[model samples]
Every structure is written in C-alpha cells, then in structure tokens.
Target: MQLKGIHHVSSLTADARRNVDFYTNVLGMRLVKKTVNQDDTSVYHLFYGDERGNPGTEVTFFEIPMAASNKRGTNSITKVSLRVPGDSALEYWKQRFEEHSVQHGDIQKQAGRLVLPFEDPEGHRMQFVSDEHDQGVEPGTPWEHSNASPANGATGLGPVRLTVKTAEPTAAVLKDIMGFSEIQSYPHPNDTDLPDIRVFETGKGGSGAEIHIETRSDLPAERQGRGAVHHVAFRVEDADELQQWIERIKNARLPNSGFVERYYFQSLYFREPNGILFELATDGPGFEGDEPFEHLGESLALPPFLEPSRSEIEARLKPID
Candidate 1:
C-alpha cells in the first residue's frame, strides 16, 4: 500500500482569527473548513487549503489560547513547506510578504530549488519552495481574499522537515512503512549544529513527495504548544488502502490509532520511533462531506456524534471573524 503524499499538517494556534487572516490573506489559501476541534469542542479547528480543499493541499489548526510557545528541539516538525508554481511566484510572495510587514528571510537555494523562508504570526515555521521541476499543483480558481492571484498563488504543500535526535529510526519508518525511498542528504540549511539532513522521496521525488529529517544529537526533546506541529498526515488512496495500512500497522506491532473515523476522512495514527506523530489518512469524504462546496467554512460544522452537543460547543467557542 502506498502512502500517497502529505494529506495535511495540523498545528496549534493562539488566536483563530489571526491564524485565519494570515493563512487566508497573506498566504493566499482558501478557508475550506471551519469547525471545532472534536476532542475539545471548546476551540476552533480551522482548515485552509486550495480551491476544493483537496487532501494534500490542506493545513489545519487547533485554536488553543494561553498555550505556551513551541520549544524547538528534536522529535518535532520544524517547518512546513508549501509549493509555489515557479520563480516568479516565489518573487511575488517575497514582495507580498515585504509589503505586508511579514517577517521573512532571504530567498536562498535549498535542495536544488529556491526557497523563501518565513513564519506565521504565531511563529509557526513556514516556507515557500519554487517548484521549477513541476512538483506543484497547477493554478485553478483564484484565492478570493488576496492579490496573490492564481498564477502566483501557493499551489499546495511541499516537503515537511522533521527534526530528530537520530535519523535511523525515523528514516526506517518513512522508507519501509510509508513507501518513501531514502533519496539523498544535504547540509541542514539553517542549523550549523546538524551535520546533515536525510531526504526521502515518496511519489515523484519532488515537492509533496519529499520529507527532510534533521539529525541533532545534542538537542533536547520538544515540548508541544502553540506554533508547534502536533502531527503530519499522509494521504491514502481510499478506504480499501486505508484498511490495508491498518492491518500493516497492527501486524508490525506499531502503536497506532486503530482506524479512527475523522468525519472528513478515516485515519490511522502512529508515532515514529523518535516521537513525531504520523497519520495515514484516506482521501474521500473530504471537506465537502458536511457542507456544500460553495458554503464551506461559512459556519461551524460538527461531526455526527457531536451534533447532540452542538449548542454547548457553539456556546464555548468565540467567533473566528
């Protein structure tokens, strides 16, 4: 069974509205789903993605006010990289970030591509990689709230960088279990402490097909909080393939959430040996499952089981915008 590519990267946010503004306005992604986190129901679970909120295109957040800042160290997702169409798009984003007063770094070459590094308002690490190698999504409907038009807008997610104390364990999970191939190694772009980063390729060996593992033997364990990535999900083809993975995970004796239904998609979650949480998610019954395509993210939506407590849940959450 092939783990397709990145389904979504979920993180924690301090303020839902601020997170929404940055992702929708500054980053030029569509707010595809607005719902409360099922586990808590007191906070918002916001989803941002491409025009249709396609599986690999999504980035979600759990609103957690008063949460501590992320402690960057080993066993954490250090950066979430989004794919932009080309060099022009990358330049447009660089200018857009500058005019908007968004903190960013110099556009530099990394892994044979141009990368523009930046952070969200809550300090969640983000980057835009120009996929000249044709590794990004093609332009479709334009993002309505921003000037980053379809031509230069973010296509979808690219590689996610995971920091770990040792690469072997995480490497094995990515390679053997997740259907990724150990591609190559590169010097850790920003960390002088890391000797080199291991790279893996899943689908086409570019953009969403990649995963970068940064080895830091000297770093401390990560403490998750706001701006920290809680988990990264990889997409599975459909229910049949998802079931296959459930069996594989169980047979391998890997600790995993046994085929949990997430409403939007069914998922199987497991932590890699180093502690980074990974999820295998199905692609169907997506963001449109509970809402129509046109009215997505317009109001709060709850999963079937939680509908009974909708009133109480709604009472607890502050309006996002």
Candidate 2:
C-alpha cells in the first residue's frame, strides 16, 4: 500500500543548544518547543519546524548532552533535507548562513532539484531544495523570531528528505511493495555541475511530503550513531492502515521489528537493503495527545506507562528556559 509522506525524522545529538542554534540560525527552522525526552527525561527533546510546530514538517531530536562522537553508518541517514519554495529561497538562506558564519557546502543540484547543503554546528548535514513549488509552510530564524509574522514562518510538517547509502533493495522495496512511484529524474537541482543524483519523491508531494532519496555512490556508507538519523518514519491514515502495512511488510519478507509504541503513536521499524532505518507510523492521537495543540512541545509529556511517575519525571527534567 502507498503511504502518505514522512512523519518525522528523529536523531540523537551530544549538545542540545548547539543543535538548537544550528537548526534555527543556519536552517531557519523555528524552535517550536523545548522539552525533555519522554523515554529519558534527563535528556532533552527538541522540536524544530515551521511556525506553530505542525507535524509532517518537524525534525525532532533527542539530546544526549555528553554523547560520544558519531560514526556515519549505513543504517543512519547522513543528511536531513528540506524542500524550499524554489531557487528564489536560496538568496534568503545564503545571507542567513553568512550571517551565522556556519560552514556550508557549495550549492549542488541533487535528485532533480537545486539544493543548498549545509551542516549543523554539531556536524549533522542538512540541505534545502529550490523546487519552486508550494512548500506549504513558513520557517522562523533564531536571529529574527521577533520579526517573523504568522505568514512567513513554516506552518506545519512538510516533506522530510533523505539520502541512502545504496539504491538497490531500498529503492526496490519502495517501488515494488511500498507502492512509491518514482515521479521523475534529472540532474541535481542545485547544480548542473555534479554527477546526476537519483531523486525519488513519494506521495502527492504534499506537506509532510515524501522523501527525496539521493545517493553518492562514490562516498562510503554511513555508520549509524548519535547525531545521526535513527529512522525515517512514514505516515498512514490510522492504526488500521498501519496494521495493513505490517502485513504487507511481512508478506514481502522484509526484516521488520514488529511494533513499538511511541506514546502518541504506534510504530513498526524495518530496514531496506540500503541500510536506512524505515518506520511506519500512525497519524492518530498525534502531538495533541498530551497537551492542547497550542501548548504542545511546551512541556514534558509521558505516555500512560509513565503517567504515574509525572512528579518524578518533572523533577528530573532541566528547565527549558
């Protein structure tokens, strides 16, 4: 069955503040909420995205203040990419990056679209595309939060982009069983200079849109570790559709790890041959479960299992402010 689009991309990092600054300052994502990790309240859970912190457009992080240096493993995504409105958005980002003094990779076209690649302060690689389409959200910059209006900031979860270590089985599963059709292909969108990169866009290409899988076959496979993507989640209409996908994954004999609860949603994790962690997640009982939409990401939220320990949990969390 075909899935909607990426639900969210979650990763681990050693330093929380640096991660926050890089995403907000360099990338222009709004730090919607600052809270503690639900699984480990001692750590921090940072959510960054378009204004109002909508789903689909979110890039989430679990901060391990003292995490060891990461190895870019095959299973973990090396870069998290975002698709902007088009080439015109580049000038805005160019000035923003220069303002922050963040080191950046030259503009290169990948997956049939122009993309500006840059790295977070903690060395997490990220890119934004110039697709010239409705990105469906606005993004806020840390340097100009007070200046951001309701209209200019990212509105919700948009597309989550990814790069794969290989294209064989991963691309195969997506095409064969996952029902993802390869829309089209072209030279890298950012530059006509580099070798062509295969771009796979899934879904209708809407907000919380599908990923653009790129490969630098010349580069080595990444090692999965902290500051690296844990998994790229795709969304379903609800739990029922998710169960259907579980059966589909089983039917295909793909290596699936059954289901795991993420408090707000249930998930099934698996790996496509190329080594990227893939997750099937439900959209129900979403970010609004623990708190009102207006108050989300503003506090530490625990699942039912941890509800009884709220007091202890709250005591262990560091103040976000």
Candidate 3:
C-alpha cells in the first residue's frame, strides 16, 4: 500500500507553557492534544494542528525542561514546513509575524513555491509555504477561533527537509526502501555552491506529500536537544496497511520498533542510513478518540493503558496553560 503523506513531526521543547503560547497564540494552530509523553510520563507531550488535529496537520513537542539548545548540523530534520492558503497568505503572515515580533525572513521562492521562513521562540526552523497551486492530499481546515484569520492561517504540513552528511544512502532508503519517487532538484536555499537539494514524493504528491533532502558535507552530526526534531512520520491508511508495512520493513532487514500501539495511531519506527528517525504511522483513531472535539486540549489526556497512572502522571507535569 502507498503511504498517504506526512503524519506529523515531533520536536523537543524545554518550556511547555511558552511553547503552547507561541504555537497557539502566535502561530494560531489549535492545541489539539494536551498529553504526557508515552515513553516518559514525567514530561508533557503537546500536539498542535489545524481545527481537528488531522493526521498530516499535527506538529508535536516533548517537554524536556533542562535540555540544552540544539546545535545545528547535518543528519537532522533541519526545517519543518506549514502550508498556508496562498501567496497572498504569505503577505498576511509576514505582516502578522511583524505584529507579534516573530523572527522571520522575507518571503522567497524555494522549490517553485513562495515561502516565508520563520523560527519559533525555541529556534525551531519552520516556514510557511503557499499552497496556491498545490494538489494531491487535501489540507486541513484552520481553526476559526485562533488569533489569525482562518483565511490566512496555516493549514497542514508541507515538505520536510532532511539535512544529511551524504545524500546517496539516505536517498536510497527513501527511494528504494520507503517507496518515495525522486521528483526533481533545486539549488539549496542557503548555499547554491553546495550540491542541489533533491526532492522526493509518494502518493498523490505535491507540497503536502514531499521530502526535501539537503546534503551538507560541511557540517557535523547534529546535537539534538531543545528545538531539534525528534522524528518525522509518514501516513499509512489504517492498521492493516501499517501491519503490512511492518512486514515490508522487516523484509528489508531494517531494525525497527514493530507494531507500536500509539493509541491514537499504530506506528513502526526506524532510522534511515543517516540516523534520522522515520516513522510509518496510521491515519485513523485520531485526537478526538478520547475527548470531545470542542474540549480537546482543555484537560490532560491519557491512553487506556496510561489511564491507571493518570494521577501520578498529572502530578509530575507542570501546568502548560
């Protein structure tokens, strides 16, 4: 079965409250899920997305209060892209970022699309990509009640950029193992002197369903901490497809966490040859499974297994709002 598109990207943050404020109040994404990191119950795992926290729209964070600042380098998810309505929306966001004092670069064209690059308070690299001419997987609806107008609000995730020491091995895993098709290449936005960045896409490809790989022999392996992306997940249709993918990955002889029950979705985690973590996750049983849509993120939520220890988990997490 073909993968749909990006499921979500999970990153690190040191301060949960400030992180929530920036994503919800400034960026205007809805805090769709307020929960604890399943692997580490002591910390908060917050999810932000368009109105309903659709699969491809989510950007998540794990709170690590004492984590060091991320040291930028190769072998990392260097930048995350969020899709806005159109080129005009870029102008809207450029003005909004100014009003909110968000650090951003002037709108520029990258890989044939107009984009406005910006960073969150924690220095997480992100850009707002215009979907004026985008096709393929549909975008999610922006939250109506957020600070930004729904017309110009960020819709869903776009192409995720992976910076690696060398491109061949990582590209091989994407093309040969993961079924991504190499579509085209473009000059690296920051350095035209380096090798051109390669673009890859899967099912119903477009801005929403592509991966941009940047090969930089110049930088060292990344020192991941706060603001570093932990992993990027691609979307599979359902549990059955995920199970089939688990078998496929096993056949490919990659070491992986097979058949993980994430509650909201099933997942299989593995790393590409360059050591960048990749996850294949199902698209159903989403954020609304536990809480009513209107009240989502208003209270801390736990999966069925974690429900027994909710009291202890709640005691450990600092209030994010």
- Evaluated with lDDT, which candidate comes out highest? 3
Please give the ranking of all candidate structures by lDDT, highest first, separated by commas. 3, 1, 2
Off by over 4 Å in 2: 24-28, 32-41, 73-75, 106-108, 134-152, 155-165, 187-195, 206-208, 215-220
Candidate with the larger lDDT of 1 and 2: 1
lDDT of 2 by residue, 248-314 (tens): 8898888898877776668888888775778888866655666675565556666778778778877
Write model 1 residue lDDT over 1-321, tens digit each, in one string. 777778899999988989988988788788989998877889999998888788778899999999998888899999999888787788888898999999899899887888999999888999998878764333234455544577787777888999888889889988887789987887778775658877787764568867898888888999998899999998888988898998988887788889888899998999889989999888888888788888888898899999999899988888877
lDDT of 2: 0.64
CA RMSD of each candidate after superposition: 1.7, 3.9, 0.7
* lDDT of every predicted structure (CA atoms): 0.85, 0.64, 0.93
TM-score-best of 2 and 3: 3
Query: What tens digits encode model 3's per-residue C-alpha lDDT throughout 1-321?
Result: 898999999999999999999999889999999998999999999999999999999999999998999999999999999999999999999999999999999999998999999999999999999998998789999998987788899899999999999999989998897899999999988778999999999999998899999998989999999999999999999998898999998998888998999899899999888999999999989988899999989999999999999888888888866
User: Could you give the candidate ranking by TM-score, starting with the highest?
Assistant: 3, 1, 2
TM-score of 3: 0.99
Model 1 scores what on Cα lDDT?
0.85
Q: Model 1 misses residue 266 by how many Å?
A: 0.5
